[model samples]
Target: MQTIRSINLQKNLGDVLRTADVETVLVTNRDQPRAVVMSAEEFIRLKTAAGEPVPNEVRKSSPTLHRRIADPLGYDTRDPGYVEQTASDALDGQHADEIAREIDKAMRRWRLR
Candidate 1:
């Protein structure tokens, strides 16, 4: 593996990227490794070989929120009410009045009931 200081990374990023096939380049700051530089294809291949899910470009081409919604015992909805429920849960951590004001503004803009 090749090691380069953070300063060298800024100066010779192109050269390091070009030599990615020979070794994975490690970027260091304060003599401690901070990041790695490798070809995207190599990184994806390594991740897939390690049994991690590789993001599908076909799925990206045709995106849907249905893929993300959690199905607890197969009980989930495509309804706007379900979205509002999730939004409300997310906003629970914040000030209720502020969240309500923001929701009201969004509803007005979208002409939502």
Candidate 2:
């Protein structure tokens, strides 16, 4: 975490934003915690890691989201509307990648196979 005074952030918006894009920055007012400045990507990633719901505004802001939303063969697993097929045993190619994602999610949360 990086600390940036609210006053400095107002003066150095670009530098602060660029830093926040790669990591979280803690914002403070008069040396007391006040707010946080973070990139939407970091915010979404953190939310996913914590099993928290990401806001629609963050989803809509992504330039590539609309294209992903339109992709039928592609999987936007982050989308709340994403559904796993009922026929898991089929192991057909259509949803193979999605199945892999399921495994990945389980491994990340459980740290075990």
Question: Quick one: best TM-score, which candidate?
Answer: 2
Question: Each model's TM-score, in the order given?
Answer: 0.46, 0.52
Worst 10 residues of 2 by lDDT: 61-70
Candidate 2, residue 82: lDDT:
39
lDDT agreement of model 2 with the native: 0.71
- TM-score for candidate 2, please give it: 0.52
Stretches of model 2 off by over 4 angstroms after superposition: 62-113
* lDDT (10s digit) by residue, model 2, range 1-113: 88999988878888888988777898999999999989877777789999999888888732225434544344454444334543433355665676677679779889786
- Report the lDDT tens digits of candidate 1 across residue range 3-100: 99998887898889887856789999999999988765576667668998756651232223354844432223422234666567666763556567
Q: If candidate 2 were superposed on the true structure by all CA atoms, what would the RMSD be?
A: 9.9
